[model samples]
Target: MNYLISALIITLIIPIWGLLIYFLNKLLYILLSKISSEKVAMTVVNYLTIPGVIHHELSHAALALLTGAIVTEFKPFWPDKTSGSLGHVNFSTRGSLFTRCLQCTFTSTAPVILGTLSSILLFAYAANNTVPFYILVPMIYLIFSIIIHASMSFADVKIMLKGIWALFIAAYIICLYFQIDFLNVIRLHLIAQL
Candidate 1:
């Protein structure tokens, strides 16, 4: 029972945690603009994005190359204060949208998603077929990583409002369907510890 509740809380917090980071970036951007020029804030966004963009695009390029496609050019978008770029990288696709999208999704999310899956599988093996372990450890790690990466690379007010709102609504529905009391459980256990 405790494990189930804990899993629910962790899952729920994942999205909210990502949202908080998104808000924090905007807050910092606003403060930087107040102190100096908007260009400075713009510069900051680009700086933050450089490494992330490189890694993400590298993943895409690697995938395309693996598929034996010609990656003609890769251009990481030059950062500017006028636009938000955590360093944008483009892969010149050499195949159908299906292949490109597959590469894109795998490139963007493989580390976190696959890593979490591995962690879950490990826990499952180690825990000796415990039901609670089936639900808890993997979910906590998976959602936590999702929150981290999503916050860093995905979440933003600049993103589509409909998409963001829709995802949130869907996630809540998922939680509800699983009969999870996420917030209350977290407050009692995890939040207090924090």
Candidate 2:
């Protein structure tokens, strides 16, 4: 069925998008390092993706707080070579098992959710062609910066995997509440694209 195919395509898009971002990040770092010292390359890349890093860390902290976790430490843009992280958030894991799982899963995945929403809004605005050239230029850069860092870090993904069941349940509940036929929606969107 077309709906089945569309669902399959939708499922494939997430991993493909993540891989594309990962490769692009690695390629940028490699190219920059070839032209300068490794440290300099790292710094340049960090600065370039600063907006996304800030957004990513803030999303984690915000969602952690919202989910009844106490944020202990928050670093928006501290590039740690040892940890290989651009930023991080530490939160207290004091809650029931289900609550803790939900907190971890939601907090870890917040960046991708918020970043994707932001990118969609930005793209819609750009598509309208109403903004001035000066504003549009920075908007494009911001969109690129946000997207490049939207993918989860390894640690985030690990945390998410530990509580992925919570995410699935939450997603299902949301779809139910919204009266969404997930496969049908995907099928319609795919047809619209074509």
Winner by TM-score: 2
lDDT of 1 by residue, 1-194 (tens): 54455454543454455456556657777988999988887665435344434444454456456644455666544544466453443444446644544344334333333333444565566566544757766555544333233342452222223133333444456666776675566578976898
Clashes of each: 2, 0
Q: What TM-score does each of the candidates earn?
A: 0.38, 0.77
lDDT of each: 0.49, 0.76
Please write out the lDDT profile of model 2 over residues 48-162, one tens digit for every residue.
7699889878888988999998999999988887978888899876687878888887787777767778888999989987899999999998888888777766677788767
Model 1 bad stretches (over 4 Å): 1-4, 52-194
Best candidate per lDDT, number?
2
lDDT for model 2, on a 0 to 1 scale?
A: 0.76
After superposition, the stretches of candidate 2 with alpha carbons farther than 4 Å from their true spots are: 1-20, 31-41, 186-194
